[model samples]
Target: MVKEIERAGLPVVHICTVVPISLTVGANRIVPAIAIPYPLGNPELPREEEKALRRRLVEKALRALETPVDGQHVFED
Candidate 1:
């Protein structure tokens, strides 16, 4: 999926909890998520805070798209 898109010349950033899996699968742009169940939002967080966290993660993904890399790169919050 992600690799196929990148192979076609489109940039792809994968947001996933398992960094090792993403790296092993050859994901060029990676963003570490909170967890597998709720990668974007944490139920424990206040609603507004969760929203902010999601936004920050998205911003990191966008930044990852603009970054050039020779291999897998993980962007952390």
Candidate 2:
């Protein structure tokens, strides 16, 4: 579905915590975070940790858009 959407000329952004999954799925525009389950935060961690994780993830996402790729690509942290 993602590739289909992109192929239609509408850009797609995949915000992923798990880099491997996004790579296997062939995501051209990708953002990577800390983990697979939460993508941004871990409830077991301190509040500061969670906040910092979220901020970093979002920043990576913004950067993913600026990157240009010839084909499917995966952005990493």
Number of clashing residue pairs in every model?
0, 0
TM-score of each: 0.94, 0.73
Candidate 1, residue 57: CA error in Å? 0.5
* Cα lDDT for residue 37, candidate 2: 80
Model 2, range 1-77, lDDT digits (tens) per residue? 76788889877778877767777877788876657788778888899988987888787777877777788777765
Top model number, TM-score: 1
RMSD after Cα superposition, model 1: 0.9
List candidate 2 segments past 4 Å from native: none
lDDT of each: 0.92, 0.77
Q: Distance (Å) between predicted and true CA of 73, model 2?
A: 2.4
